[model samples]
Target: MIFVPLPYVVALLLAILLIQMVRRSDGNKPNLFFAALIAVYALQSLVIGTRWGYDIVALLPVQAILAAIIPALAWLSFEGLRDGRSPRNRPLLLLHALPALMILAFVAFWPMPISLALIVIFLGYGSALTWLAWLGPNALGSSRLDGVGNAYRALQITAFAILGSGFIDVIISLDFAETGGTHSGGIVAIGNVLALLILGTSATVAGTSQPASEDDGSGNEIPSPVPSAEDARIAASLDELMQTRSLHRDVDLNLNRLARKMGLSTRQVSGAVNRVKAMSVSQYVNDFRVKEACRLLANTDDPITRIIFDAGF
Candidate 1:
């Protein structure tokens, strides 16, 4: 009978997910990093599968390398989704790689140290992800994603998957100790394969749900403003701009562009819209687009396709 490794099957699915991310990534750093994380997990599964399924002793060091890097990739990808900032701090990111570097250095001579290091990395990063999830949507405030509410749910699932990975490692370690380092490889492979499936799918869903949109603006925080004449004036000016120029029809309009057109700062625009409309700037903009769409739909004989485009939706 021809041998078929489960990891190979799972890794193949993950590879397909990675390719989808790349095709739809559109230069979003968060998505790209997420894809990289998925790639690492896929390779990790493949390595573990090969080492156990074929009993390849020489591949042990390679497995060690992939395992060591998993936590680092997890943390970095989480940061990417949280911050939604491109061109991240490269120097700091390089620091996360230290664990993997240490593993590569000691894998040949001191395998025990590598094993201990992986344990610490998994536990530490897993706890960190869990804590981040505990913070809820506020933790994802900096993200430019559209469906933050849904994304947060996906984030929680991803966190649990990482946390599960840590627990799996602990269980495997205990099994190794109990069996004199001869625990069942099938169990380890199955656990990791399931984990990669969950993590890869959750991360992909969360990352893709937040595609770049014109309404996302710069995603800079806006200070809340007291309702006052200045706020009303700014809001009125924005209203006039939208009405007179039909700027809402642009479909590419954002806070910065709207602010620039009105000769106001982005902060002022955001503040004014928030205080006057009692809603987010994106919401305020969408309201106008929705109204226009409604008008087009009711009064014109335009198809929905044309109406959506014409109404800036």
Candidate 2:
């Protein structure tokens, strides 16, 4: 009988996900980063299966480097959704790659502390991602409002998966220390495969929150100017515009398009809505949509399905 390892199965699933993402991509940076992350996870799973199942000792370093990369990519993919800033504008993005580069350096000369470094990297990124998610859907200012909640939940799941992987590493290390590496194979086979699968799936789900635009100039570093009288004015203008033009009825209405229509930056519009309405931009627009839907349902004899579509739901 031929035997197939669990990681190989995971690798195959992730590969399919990567292909799907690539095919569906709208040339968005978040989508591209998500595809790259899935591809990396698939590659890592393949390397793990080969090394553990086939006893391919030569692949150990490759596995280590890839493991280091997974968390970094996950972080970048989600971070890109929070604001539509491109990679070039975010200089700190290069810092995220340091962990993987360190792993590579360790692979070359000093391999002893590689496991410890990986644990730190995983836990650190996991915590950061968890915090980002904890900030709620509003934190992903650039994300499409319709899918922001799902993206936030996906971030939480991915964070937990990354943290779980770190804990699994701890368990495997303890197993090796206590049992002379006897049960490490089974633990790695099961624990890693599960973690990577969850991570990949959650990441794909998070990627669903596409940004409104790639270059809306919403830099994460710059603080949104404090709410002022101008914010109230902008909010009032936006309200008038939405009522007059029924912009909320457009199913594709997003921060970028709305801001462009108003002749303002996304930050200006989002900040105005957030300040004046005490809600996210999506919530504010969605309130108008909900109200319109209610009015239509009460007055018009339109079919419920048609009402939903007409209300931009």
Candidate 3:
């Protein structure tokens, strides 16, 4: 309410924090996701701006708009596909349209009290969340999102938390209603704080927080490695190598040379391979080399040493 700019203050802080997060991220995907979050703030401003000295009644339509946007933002932030494309054939951009649709729904059902409108508002929001889980990245294979150690699990849990919150809110509202809005009086306030806390925590874990982790700018946090010209050449070479009768045959193949070819630092390449495949680069390479050797041995290879060398040992 304008009388007590708490909502505006909270929303403004979160909006700023999220924008900073986007700026700190080295990846475009995370940046895009956080941009959606910024839009949420813009939305809040749009609704509340009209009420300078008025009560929260002026903010109801704003909340109505937010109902759909909240869920949509959650989906975009956490559940984008492996390539960052939405699972929806149209790229799931449809999720962003939800806020408008919801606002329209409110107008179509106008003259309803803010309370009743909120009911339908939450209903649409909840449905969007469920749909995201059903058809978005949540339904995709877990292996992709859950990479290694607790990384994938962390992501999955956050995704679940977003969807779960909607249900929890429903139960809270029911209880609040049973006891007359008293219980829900400060509910929105509490929810706002908690939401930012959760998002901030996730941003920290996801490497979007600043002042940087390890607190060092000199080089504790490595730069993002992309496919340079040389790296692309190496990738292409590796692809061709994989097509051969023997590629993984080199059990002791030097990683330095591979990293050199790929235009990646040894640490960067190692981390990427390990995180993506859940195995050390050496072990992965060695295992593949052994498999190739075995295949040649069982099939029709001229000699074991030849097969070993051919396999990239």
Q: Which candidate wins on lDDT? A: 2
Alpha-carbon shift of residue 232 in model 3 (angstroms): 25
Model 2: per-residue Cα lDDT at residue 148? 64
How many angstroms is residue 69 displaced in model 3 relative to the true structure, after the best TM-score fit? 1.0
Ranking by lDDT: 2, 1, 3
* TM-score head-to-head 1 vs 3, winner: 1
For candidate 3, which ten residues in a row score worst on lDDT? Answer: 141-150
lDDT of 2 by residue, 37-94 (tens): 8889889888888898998989989999999998998888889876667888898989
Q: Candidate 2: where are CA atoms >4 Å away? A: 26-30, 200-237, 244-283, 287-313
TM-score of each: 0.71, 0.75, 0.50
Question: Candidate 2 — which pairs collide?
Answer: none
Pairwise TM-score winner, candidates 2 and 3: 2
Which is the winner by lDDT between candidate 2 and candidate 3? 2
User: Over 4 Å off in model 3, which ranges?
Assistant: 1-6, 25-30, 41-54, 86-92, 95-100, 110-154, 208-313
CA lDDT of each candidate?
0.70, 0.79, 0.50
What is the overall TM-score of model 1 with all chains considered together?
0.71
Residue-by-residue lDDT tens digits, candidate 1, 22-129: 776556433555667788878877887788889887998998788878777776665665544563555577788798888888986777866677777788887887
lDDT, candidate 1, at 221: 37
Count backbone overlaps in model 3.
10
